[model samples]
Target: MLRIRPRALPVPATVLAWPVAVGSLALAVAALVLHASTVGGLRDTTNLHLADLWLSVLGPTVGAAVVARDRRTGLVLLGTAPIAVGAVAGAYAVWSAEVGGAPGAAAAAWLATWTWVPFFLPALLLPVVLRSGAAARLGAPVAGVLVLIAVFSAFAPGPAGPFAAVPNPLGLAWAPWLGPAAGVLIGLTAVVLVPAAALLAVVRWRRASGDDRWQLGLLAAGEAVFVAAHLSPVTAQPLSDVLVAVGLTALLGSVALGVHLRSVTAGLRRERELLATARETERLRLHRDLHDGVGPELAGLALQLGAVASRTGEPVLRELEGRLREVVGEVRRVVDDLRPAGLDASGLAGALRERARAFSAGDLTCAVEADVPDGLPPAVEVAAFRIAAEALTNAARHAGASTCTVRLGTEPGSLLVEVADDGSGIRADAGPGVGLASMRRRAEELGGTLRVGAGPGGGTVVRAVLPVPR
Candidate 1:
């Protein structure tokens, strides 16, 4: 059954991201139209303008979706930077287009800012995503260089600077040489960092498994197509725009697919666990019913047969009574095998202690030291007890052990049971038999593990670790 819990509304990243992208695209198209109308025709609009508009819309959409899906702090910071830059630049473009400024200067500034700035955020983040720590180390210096470039561009004086499109937009024209010098630095930094990020992504792709590889491959392909569209000669503007749009759509689609796959995988895993738990619960209930119902019936029958044997001294009756008593014992044993009574009565510790006592016989000393907390789930307790009993039995009978120890304790989020014997170590040819296999199965049924091997003191050790369900 699917359970839905009431929670506060999810952050609106997914909801906001796509609409923002579409709106940005519409605004960009509007800006282009305005420019075309003002300047007289579509022929006046540059391919660079089209490329910038697409990039500005595409970058933030991808970023927002990624940040929402991953929810990583680093990704959030990285994704937000591009969106912030784009928003400001987009607003400026609208203002410049509608209000009309130093003819084409403002439009050029908007195009340049959007074209260069939007891609930089994704490029910077790519390295971090690819090779987490190594990327961080490498990216720090690259980031510092980029920051230096920004500082230089902002403070640079004249229109010939790196940020020439929006020259002195920040009113840094007080220093002319600063802009040109920073622009050079920015170009050089991009040349180095962009290739490095791409290389890191390639390395990541080589190492990535399953869904991750697909996601990375799709992102790479989309980015490559988008970049190629911009670089290719602009023979047909409409065709170019269509191609760029297709590339961006592909990239966004991949992100969505990845998110969907992750959610489906998680849901499937939860369902499997729930199904397993249900099966176990039903098994335990059946065992409990058999123990509670049939066990007492057989015991009562044995008692009545004994009373009959005393009353009537017939040979057949006596013989039948003996056989019936054996059958009763066998029935009880079967019930205990299915689910230990001690486990039901007093939890794991009591169960282990009782088992240890039962296994203790002449020439074999069995000691149980258990500090397990009370009220563990019935399944866990039962499995742990069974495993421990089997281990102790093996140590006492097969191991030729004089001294056997059963220890029960708790580890973080789990219960630990270990049965060790100081005896002749496991024989090489003495393969795992039904008893050992049974113990292992019991442990595994409860999503736990069992290990049987030579102990530290040159004897056998049987250890089972069972998870404690909350």
Candidate 2:
């Protein structure tokens, strides 16, 4: 399997990220301000530290957003660039600490939770969702629900009923073992969750797609409800042990459904994508066959007929030669109609100029103006070239065009290519010609656009604009 390189964030996103960081920093500062001015300072109550810790937790999400951005933009080729997973984990740890700016129990817990996201995000969610079929798509929502559940469980308002915690840790019956044990339990849950999710994702990706979307949804819904029950305001008991059992059962059921559906969907989507690709490949092959085999055979037969007409020197020779010439010309036209490999080989300018020159030698004129830098990304180059070729081809073959001008250059932060022809005006609704359709597809696939309309002095003009390299 090919590994995809994640991209860098866009300019707007890069700018946005710093503000999020600054906003988080401001929150910490506000915590400090509130801490000092209120009833007591940092030494008096742990709430200030807790506030700061929560603010610090926001930092890793920013970092996670950055990681997500990298994946979105195709900049994360680091999968092959010798970067170790531990290094990524360490970086997140350091970033979390720096963002925290101080150490406390709450800060530690926040840092630990925030840091867990990156590892689990890619290792767990990415594998299952991206690689899985329909289940993977549903996996995103499921994962979101789970995270929400966890957050709700962690921060749910304490002690609706009598069994809730005492105000201070010192006087509580189980404070000594309970606090540490709860922390340990959370950590252990994370350890188990990460590996289990990852393992399930891997299995699903490797499996076939007969998975049920509804079952997955039901399981997710059930877990959400189960988790909600414990965290609900109406819970009769403050520390209901029964609630824990119900939540765990729901969690176990959800996981089982997730594992099964994930495998099936992954298999299904993979097969469907493969089939689509294969179909496209077959279509291309058929096009090649018609162009290479049938078209040439027709032309060869026309040549043979022309030879017979000449050798006989009959009165019908001129008529025969004319008919054969027309046949050969039409054969050539059909071949050209079938494919435009010239555009692929020589760039758009060369192909357009060749078409223009072939169409008109004296009364018609054609020129190519190109200022493209060397080594433009191949996809961009191909798209630009094809648009130019299509415009010129349409003009010469259909529009009775006399003059054509093609230009390729950079405009602002975009690559712009335009082809204009002085010919009969084009249709308002361009017909679905293969040439036109191919040009549009090429443009769109590269995050660019194509426009064709009337030229100022009658005829048609085509333009393509694409993003410049970041």
Highest lDDT against the true fold, candidate? 1
Residue 130, candidate 2: alpha-carbon lDDT: 37
lDDT, residue 193, candidate 2: 56
Kindly list the per-residue Cα lDDT of model 1 for residues 2-21, writing each as its tens digit.
Answer: 99999988766666666666
Q: Write the per-residue lDDT of candidate 2 for residues 1-470, one digit (tens) a residue.
A: 99999998566545545455555455445444533443322223222223123314333333334333333211111111111212222233333333444334232333223222232232234334432355556455545644653343333232211112112212234334444444554555455554454455445434432243344354344445444543446534324434533543454345444545655655665565455445534544655776678767776776777788788877687687688768767766764544455644665556656766775665567788877765555445555666776777787778887788888888776799888888888777766788878886666555466777788888888888876555
The window of 10 residues in a row where model 1 has the poorest summed lDDT is 39-48
